[model samples]
Target: MTAPAIRTGRAGPEGGSRRLILDMAARLLRSGGYHQTSLREIAEAVGIRKASLYHHFASKEELVEAVVNDGVRFVDEAVAAALAAAAQAGPRQRLEAAIAAHLAALHGHGDYTSAAIKVFTFGSGPVPESVRLSRRLYEDVWRGLLAELREAGGIAPGRSPEALRLFLLGALNGSIDWYRPERFDIAALSREFAALVAPNGVDAAK
Candidate 1:
């Protein structure tokens, strides 16, 4: 896929400069893991100096946090929207919609997803509590959905909602390691994953 268009200048009509830096940083993080990404490189990508870049972000760690936080927020919002949209739909429909929305966000927000996953699964050292909390919030959103499905008798009663929630999340998030949107559309892949976790092959049609 073509690289996302890069914008420049100091916060344009819609606060563009700050967004440009974040976008550049996110792209860099996606192409090269967090360890290899640097503020200087982000600045250079935005056609600015490293010193000027610090004007927006206090340090590399801060920038990393910002990128991660933004990603988490984006995901949280997507989940909320999906759940709201699928409120009237059946459990399987809700779950599929939620998963598809998440995958789309991950695909479009590649940089944030890459950084968030890297920091979450294999961080170098102690991450800021805020980062951990943000990750938890994202997980909780999924767990909440699973709980709703359980209440609706969508999943088998014998299985723990928490366990099933983890299973679903593990399967969905694991896609980042291997998923190529060009090869598999979000809807088709999410449906396949949802079916894998459905109890007793419930609603295979979904």
Candidate 2:
């Protein structure tokens, strides 16, 4: 099933009150973490009354569920689109395409993606089941991609698909903290990472 599209642009007044609230919520959640963010803060950020937030989301958890899901959906769709574009390409090429797409989406939609990661990673409170499910679904996409690469012998012989997937995603996601657009290009970063993990060990051709 197709997930709802995440608003990638600024949510002006015409963008619908709900979307504007989501945009602000994601930004706050990204900057302040889940616990540090509040419904009143999100409402204020969106220039709406705190009571207005309830009209869209019954509680803070419900609002967070939406933001977290949107975050995963945005990257999942980006990677899916990139893979479809490279459907006829070789496994290595396809992997590179996926990497580039993931990085682009990660940095391009930093607020949503970063908030999702930080909320999931550091939140000490209970997480909604739907939010966990959404994350698992997105991770499955990478698992499938890595499984394909392993089948094609693109991964080292001794490496497990799950291990490689975790490592790759961890490294990629961690870039949100240190990646500098002026210092590095997403395409180059993707190629460099792909080469590092390629079976042949630093195969520029791959």
Q: Which has the greatest TM-score?
A: 2
Q: Residue 116 deviation, candidate 1, in Å? A: 1.7
Cα RMSD to the true fold for all candidates: 6.1, 5.1
* Tens digits of per-residue lDDT for model 2, 33-85: 88889888988988878997787798888899899889988888989999999
> lDDT tens digits, residues 1-206, model 1?
58455544545534468777888887887667678887779999999899987888888888878888887788778878998987777777888888888887787645677667655555677778888898888888888778867766677768887888877777677777888868888889888877766644443343
Candidate 1 lDDT score relative to the true structure? 0.77
Error of 1 at 117 (Å): 1.7
* C-alpha lDDT of residue 190 in model 1: 82
Which regions in candidate 2 have their CA more than 4 angstroms from the true location?
Answer: 1-15, 199-206
Model 2: worst 10 consecutive residues (lDDT sum): 6-15
